[model samples]
Each structure stands twice: as structure tokens, then as C-alpha cells.
Target: MFQSTKQTAQTANLTAGGHALPADWLGRIVLIWSGYAVSMFAGNAASYAGIWYATETTGSPLSLALLYVLAFLPMGLLSPFGGVVADKLNRKVIIVVCDALMALTSLALAAWTFIAGPSFAAVALYCAAFGFVSGFRTPAYNATMPLLVPECHLVRINSMDTLLGSISMIAGPALGILLYTSFGLQYVLILGGFGAAAAGVTMLLAVIPRDHGAHEQAGAWASLKEGASTLASQRGLLVLTIGVSLGMLAYGPIDSLMPLMVYDHFGGDGFAASLVAAVMGAGLLVGSVILMAVNPRRKLARIIVVSAFVVGTGALIAGLIPKGGYWAFVVCIGVLAIACAWFNAPLMTLLQKNIPDEKLGRVMGLFTAMNGLAIPAGTALGGLIAEVTGTPLFFQIDGVFILLLAVSIAISKSVRKLDAASSDHPTVEQTL
Candidate 1:
């Protein structure tokens, strides 16, 4: 009985990290994820500063919109190559380089905020250049994460990432609001810049173990071709990326217009606008925690199908609700965040699992790229809808498009069969 009990106890101590995961791997995730969390917090705080600083001093709505649009333009254009770099180079080095670059950008923003003040054109130019630099890092990190954790527990680790990011999302905006209100946006901008630099310093200390199985034989162009070809082969991942892109297109407008939503509805104070955004971030935190608790053991394809449906349903419901003003709109968005979290967590897990490590970066790059693929279009759609209708209809129509995309994925048998075998087959996806 004593021996049997000992065996049971040992089994209980073992986590999913034991399978397809290295020994002492969880330690690495904690070490790396902690550094990443701080870095992201400072980075996002700087983002909030950029938006609020531009809006308060310059008061240009277009400048405000430029903040969102310009930030993403880099990712949209360069993400494919970023992924290729992730596969060819050491992922740890890539992450360090990316964080270092962000640190520099943050410092530049701080300088610009103080020295240049708020020039709409200057801020626009600043944002565009910053966006260009960020594109390479996004895919690099996504592909690198699985190197830190095991496969079977991808959901738990992803939920962990979301939880950390949620902390950043909630804190960054709130910090931006508080600093901007009390110390002024200039100080907030400067502080965020320093924080990003500090994060870079922290990231420099992290050591990611090497993957012996990683692809190293090919040159940059040849490696790029191989990664692209693999993604193209995965019909399921391709469909999934496209569906995710639709949801992202719908969601982008929400961030761009939230400040206006707060003013129209919440009382026109910067605090009120920031509070409205914070509620959604808080909901995301809650939702991520919940997902971590109850990871689905079913098919990857099915989880995605259900998640998309839920996202569409939430957007539809939020759109159907009557908007009384800012606070009311925020309340609706908060609920929407829950739905978004549920769908996003599982979809992320699916991508991390099916794609091989060698090509994971570029694949995740393409995956991440899909998030912004329709942004230019979403902006046009949102602007047109806002003019003709209102925010509510904008949400509803985008929700419908998201739902249709999900349905398209569900209907394709080939796409839905990604989990039929446990083989780590090379996969391929394309946007154009």
C-alpha cells in the first residue's frame, strides 16, 4: 500500500510539461514569461501614452486614429519575413532583439513627446516608423513560446500568456490614465519609455534552451520557401487563420473608437475613456483564468468552431443592445471581451500544437498577420458604417462576417480533421 501510494503521489506531481516538454521547462517559462510580461506592460503603457498624448494636446481625431492604424501597418507588411527569421535564427536572440528595438522606440517617443510636443503629422510619422520596427518581433515571439513549454499543455501556457498580457493591458491603460491626469502625458510618455528599456535589460538575462530538432540546413530564402510551403500544406491552419482575421477586422474598430465612445457616453474625461477600455481588459483577464481552469480535451478543430461562434454571438448581442452613452457602451464591450477570450485562447492553442517548431515562427507570423489582414478594409468598413449607421450596427455586421467565416471553416472536412493523427506534419497557410 505504501509503494502504491508513493507512485500515485509521484504521478500527481507530474504536469503536462512532462510530455513533449523538457525537464526543468516550466521554470524556463516562468523565467521567460515574467520578463516578457514586464516588457509588454511597459510597451503597452507607452501605447496608451501615445494615443492620449496625441489626443489631449493636438486634439486631432485623425491623429488618434493614426495611432492605431500606423502601429499595425508594420505587422501587416513584414510579419511573413519575421516568421522566416524566427525559424532561421535563435528564437531567444530574436526575442531579445525585438524587445531591444521596442525599448529604443519607447525612448524615442518620450523624446518626441517632450522635445517636439504634439504635432499631428509628426506623431503620425513617428507611429508609422514604430509600426515598421514592431513587425519582425511579433512572429518571432509566438514561434519561440512552444520552445519554452511542452505540447499537450499548450492551452495552459497560452492562458498563462494571456493572463500576463491582461495584467499589462489593464495596468498599462490605467497607469497611462493616472500618470496623464496627475503628472501629465509627457511624464507618462517618458516613464513608459524607461520601463520598456528596463524590460529589455531584464530580457537580456533569460536563457532559452536550444532545440536540437530545429531546422538549420537551409539559407534564408530557402528556409523561407520551406516554411511557406509547409504552411500551405496545412488546410486546417489556413482556414483557421482566415477565420481569425475576420474576427480581428471586426475588433480593430473597437479600439480606435473607444475614446470617442467614452466621451459620448462616459463623461468626456480621460479617466472615463480609459476606464471603459480597462473594463474590457479586466474581462479578458477573467476569461483567460477561466480557460486555464477548464481546458477542452476535444478536437482542436471543434474548439475553434465553437469559439468563433461564441465570439460572433457576443458581438451580435452587444450590437443589439441600445447604447445609452459611454458607460453603457463600455458595459457592452466588457461582456464582449469574455466572448473574445474564450474563442481566442483555444484558437491560439490549435496553432501552437499543429505547427512544427522549425517553422512555427513564420506560421505564427502568418497567423498573427491574419489578425490585421483586413484592417485597411475594417477601417473603411467602420468609417462607412459609423457615418451611415452607428457603433451598434458596426458591431452587428462585423459579428455576422466573423460568424460566416467560422461557418466556412466548420463546413470544410479537410480543415476540421487536423487532429485525426498526432503527427507533427509541416503546415502551410496564405493570405493572398
Candidate 2:
């Protein structure tokens, strides 16, 4: 389905609307990026606390799990329409509006936590509301990045964003844990409210380029229709998306099962339980930095395919090893970190390069939705698998599934030649 080398040569568009960054544009980018990093820390600070609140108050894993299910479910279910909205509206406007709504939800959740105990239903409602807004925001955020910075600096900017965000993910959970253990869950949630509100307000101040609703825009159904049409036509791009989606599905079992396995198979908890997540995130940041130097487009198939294989193998080995300790666990997780970093940036960049700017949100909406949908099902399936075959056996079985994806892609000509063909084969009107 992908364009051959000869065809891509005709389609390549090296010179789009903007040139490489000048000094002023670089400064503006830094200003916006820094704001986003700070807001992310605050907006997500209460995640661990929310879980702790549900567990401590109700003594129920189901109560805590409710928050997660609510978060992922709406994001996946509503994302297609959300993408349509993004394409139909100004992206900056959509982001600002969504951030504001999230802030309100955060604030309300904090208020409720302070006044009374966390009812499972109340927490689920808050999580779901935030998830809905976030689901909408992701495509807009992805679509906006290339506009905020120059094409030449796209990789650097994306790497920096992922790096900083990964750090925030680690710190936020730890902070929530500490806040809940010492002062209590209510205070931590209040802090989360403030963070979300601040993130929303600062977003209003940042001047982002407008690229949404540029065309008359398609209706909701038409938006998805357009997205599918685009992918259907681009052979390389379609295979790439499917490969990544499958990778996510297979990796989910490891992510869901590993912690449980560590706690039960080995005797690690509290700080140790948290460390597993932190280590993986830390590895992701490190891997992202490494890949910044090694562009995926240069060897797109090898990286995506091999990295996925590594994740699958590492997960199985980690689960199967009889007496491995913290060090082994950390190392195996680091392997996954490598795979994840290798996968993210280029996949989206490839889409951005191939798809028209007017349709980015719509296309990314499908992307966002697929990712959202995959996570919940993967997680649920992992839990179910563990129940049947046991966690250790499930990880090993899932590892085999991940391996199958790599095998599938390696044999497919479209994916194997994607990078080389995309760069050389199409004209892409590169000199626009």
C-alpha cells in the first residue's frame, strides 16, 4: 500500500509553510513548552492520592479501579467525535477550552474530597470528566506541535516534551503518595485542583498558531470518513498505525501484570511497588533522549519492529525468571522503555508528514482513540489472562503475541520499506 521509492520522490515536501527556527521563534517555543511541563505536573498531581483516597476510605480495589476504568473508557469512546471537533474548531481554542473544563473538574473533585469521604461514584465521575476533556485535547496537542516550533526542530521539541512529561509522571505519583501518607488525601487533591487551574489559565496566555477549521471542515461522520480515507490510500502509513496499535495491545499485559507479579511473586510493596512505575518512566525518558540522535525515519521499520520485539521478550523473561530481584525487574523494565521511546515520535511525525494539515486533527483523533481503546482492553484482558493462567504465565503468553506483530510487520513490504520509500519515492511537493 505504501508508495514505492520512485513514487515518494515525487511527493516529498521538504519545504512546507515555514522555514527552520530563528531565535525569536525558539524563545516562544521554550516559553510555551515550559508552561506545559509545569501544568502537567500540577494537573496530574492528585492521581495517586485519588487512588489512595478510594482505597483507604472504602478498602476496595474495585473502588480505586473505578477511577482508571472511567478515565480510559470515555477517552476511547468519544475521541473520534472529539477529533471532528478539533478539526472543525481552532486547535488552540479547543485546547484552552478543554484545559479549562478539566480545571473545573479538578477543583470540584478537591472540594468534594475535603467536605466528605470519596464515594466511588463521585471519584469515577471526576475521572471520567477529565478523561473526556483530555481525549479531545490530545489530537489538538499533537497537531499543534509542528506549528509551535519549526520543522527542523520538531524532533528536538517532541523529545523535550516527552522527557519532561515523563519526569512529571514519576514525581507526581510520588508526591501524591507522600502527601496522602503524611497530611492526608484531601490536601493533595486540593493541590491537584490548583495545578489544573493554573495549567488552564497559563494556556490562555500562550500564543499558539491557528491551524484548525481552516477548511470548511467535515461533519463528525465525515471527519472519520476522511481519516479512514486518508489512511486507506496511504499504504505505508496505514500499516504503521496498525503496527503501533498492536504493539500497544501486547505491551499492556506487561504493564498491568508486572506490578502484581512483583508484589506477589516477590515481596516488594509500598515504595517498591511505586518504584516499578518510576523506573519504567525514567527509562522511557532516557530512551527518548537516545532516539533523538537516531531518527526513526532513517530506519523506521527496524526500530518499530525490533523495539516491539524487545518489549515482548523482556516482559516474558522478567515474568519467567524464578528468583530475580529489584535489579532484574528494573533492567527488564528498562528494556521496555527502550522500545516505547523508539516507537512514539516518528510514528506521529510520519503521519504529520504524509497527511494534509487541515486533516491532522481528524487523523490524529483516530490515532488517539485507537490508543485509548487499546489500553483498557489490553489491561482488562491482561487481568483476565492472569486469572486464568496466572500472572507469570500470562506475561509469557502476551510476550508471544507481541512477537507475532513484529513478525507480521517484518514480512509486510509496506511497513518494511516505509521510511526509505516515504522519503525517496514520493514527490510530496517537497518544495512548497
**Top-TM-score structure, candidate number:** 2
What's the count of clashing pairs in each model shown? Answer: 12, 24
Model 2 residue 107 lDDT score? 73
The TM-score, computed over Cα atoms with residue i paired to residue i, of candidate 1 is: 0.84
lDDT of 1 at 424: 35
Give the Cα lDDT of each candidate: 0.65, 0.68
lDDT of 1 at 176: 76
Over the stretch 142-215, how does candidate 1's per-residue lDDT look in tens digits?
Answer: 66666666554677877776777677877888887787667655676566556656555655676665552364
TM per candidate comes to 0.84, 0.87
Off by over 4 Å in 2: 1-23, 51-67, 295-297, 423-432
Best by lDDT: 2
